[model samples]
Target: MQRRANVELRTAYNAFIESKRMSDPASGLTEIPALNQTLKPHQHDIVTWALRRGRAAVFAGTGLGKSFMQLEWARCVAEATDMPVLILAPLAVAAQTKREGEKFGIEVKHCREQSEVGDASIVVTNYDRLQKFDLEHFAGVVLDESSILKASDGKTRTAIIEAFKDYRFRLACTATPAPNDYMELGNHAEFLGVMTQEEMLAMFFIHDGGETQKWRLKGHAESEFWKWMCSWAVMLRKPSDLGYPNDGYDLPPLAIEQITVGVDHDRAQDTLFVMQAATLQDRIKERRETVEERCRAAVEIIARKPDTPWLVWCNLNSEAELMTKLIADAVEVRGSDKVEDKERKLLGFTDGQIRVMTTKPSVAGFGMNWQHCADMVFVGLNDSYEQLFQAIRRCWRFGQTKPVNVYLVAAETEGAVVANLHRKEADAERMAEQMVAHMQDITVATIRGTSRTKTEYNPSVEMTIPQFLEAA
Candidate 1:
């Protein structure tokens, strides 16, 4: 009788364990219909997996056909639900996505206001115009550069997440999803309704100390955190990361040349010896003081490849003005420019009409594909590594035949800024590798439709009856 009781107790315990296992319910379609024929194999699989998951994030690297996969996902979702789908992109990327849709035989209506979205199956608009449209009308929503959820101001970020919390189908595509900052993962998770940021923190993370803002993953929960992430998202830097052939996805070699313009030590106000700019204010002042010298160095680099297309990035209005003035025939896009003017100039560069383009990374860094231009220049350095990475990726992404050349022109006293950027870059690369390592096998299995999330129950030891029960 005691043995029988023990058997029943073990059965109940096993059942309880199974009930508590982590799982992401499939709110998406069970059977994925035929996808677009034009999609490459990896893209087709990714779209299929996204449709199966219903609401998902595709953290694919740039130039890996995210545009194509997103378009196809929107098309299929619209067709499946028989309701219109909305895709929100960065300012100029909406226009570019519309053009890409045309090539893929998908009609992408670009709308500036809600009234213009009438009867369109797949509508595309910029995030700045999201307020004009009503979310109730669409069955699915796609965020093209979804990283904006974390990068944008808190008000804008909250509005996006709150607006799409209940959408039936949602997809977010971005290359960088909090590469170095793990907390940023909460933004994506909360946006997808997988888990709230607070809930994720409570479950898998621990505060480092008295500081409330900084959190790190708990050591014991590391594997479980990744498992939960794989249930709702797919991250891959390349096709091979998911066991797919990287035939045309290989990026060409990138050559980064750092050019430090000399600063006159005789002009030092407080000290006879030059010191590296240590603070943000000092860095800005240093950049302002040496703009002409840095811009001249950039101009000289551009002259080396006179006819080549160059994408020049600047931080200050003064830098933009000076660089454009120095480089004849160069077009400058500033933050103060009208949205129409910015899009026109950006598209002009993409179309090869503008040979040398000057813009801020904050303006044109997010979603433009400038693989046509193999050469780029940063007039000066900023502390934002993500911006720098995105800026360089514009010209260095896949499909460029020539070796990409990036010139980082900074003042001599800004060595600290350069060193800081390198350190952050290394951290980002290491973190990205860790992220991919944790998610790669699960993502590959998910893409192949064989991934499972249940924690297997294996009782390795015999379940002995408790002494109290035996005595009873």
Candidate 2:
């Protein structure tokens, strides 16, 4: 069989060479490089992560091939257990993951909405679609962009929790797992069933010891808790623990002009915040001018920089709606956009034809690369670090040569969300450092060749350097 295969391959190669000679005499089609070739250091960690059993978390940064890690793990788990794997993600992100799998040459089926999935070992779907199906059939589960579960009442989150209630082989992949607050981590951990939400709050978190119950987080302590908890799971980061060629991406020079919406615009525009539902009406009343002024500014900026492509990230529908009408040539790519159209617009932007593509980061961020536009204009921000990280990384990828610049064109009222972004980035760095310190032990755990319950995390008779995070 080996001799027959070699003869077949050699014949095919010779045929290709003869065919090329018929076309261009000097032409040679060199074999393409492997998609996972020259993987970042953290990428290696991701491979180690999926080899084990139980639940795991590959908390890797953007451009780190996390989807590959997830896919590779799913393949291994399927081979071992012969049970199918289900990957749950957002609708748009599901498409992105499908594309990633194809790019990496992984054969997986994406179940159509409301359709019955077959024996395809790895089945990927959106949260909405996953909610519609029976998840008990899957032996493995991966929650990409896991932070979407931060909102307890979210339809997607609620559906996932209810569906995967009995699921043990869980893995949550995200760079900004807990962006807004530590409470976000509870959902992912709970899905892992490593510790329940109640256990997490009681064990990892503590209230600010002040008179009031203001929440003050304990950062690395909780990180350490995850480290001990995620022996089966692994959290990896980039540019440090995973040394990818950060400077390899040749980005175009970015020149951003900061445009701040001042409070002196009008009575309504001046007032940007509302404390409650009672004030929600007042918030709208106050936003009338502010919203109008921002629309005018969008026009002004586009008119000023007519040549450069502008990406306006508006949070409120009012802002986005107005801009869509005012800017005649502009295209707004939102969550509600058709998958093909959204993909077309993104491809257009990357291919250097489309100039301006206005969108909310929640819609355009994650697994979509618009490296053509090195200059990003943030029209608004939400309480999500995952979106921000994915949004910024769209420009700061491997092909970008120039310095990627993010222009924060925000109204002062959106301070809390902006603060949250900075906090999350800094928090991720510290988590990255803590992870690097224990790299060897984590690597050993992955190759341990045995799965254990939390009580018996001891791999005594197994591979070398058997030490837990608690022991370390």
TM-score of each: 0.90, 0.71
lDDT of 1 by residue, 322-426 (tens): 999998899999888999999999999999999999999999999998889999989977788889999998888888788999889998888845567778888
Give residue 78's error in model 1 in angstroms: 0.4
Stretches off by above 4 angstroms in model 1 are 1-24, 210-212, 416-419, 443-445, 448-472
Compose the digit string of candidate 2's lDDT tens values, residues 1-472: 6556556666776566555321101111122112255445455445554444446667665556677888876766666677888887754567667777788777678776436577788888866566566666777788887776873366666667767767656778875554335566667766766566666566556777774434544675655564555553455444444333444324346444456566553434345543321344543443554777667766776676677766777777777888878887777777677766876776667667777778887776655655566666666555556666667877776556656666665444433434555677788667556555565355443433344434222224522332452244
lDDT, candidates in the order shown: 0.86, 0.61
Number of the predicted model whose TM-score against the real structure is largest:
1
Q: After superposition, how far is residue 212 of candidate 2 from its true place, in Å?
A: 9.5
Clashes of each: 0, 14
lDDT over C-alpha atoms for residue 363 of model 1: 92
**Candidate 2 clash figure, as a count:** 14
Best by lDDT: 1
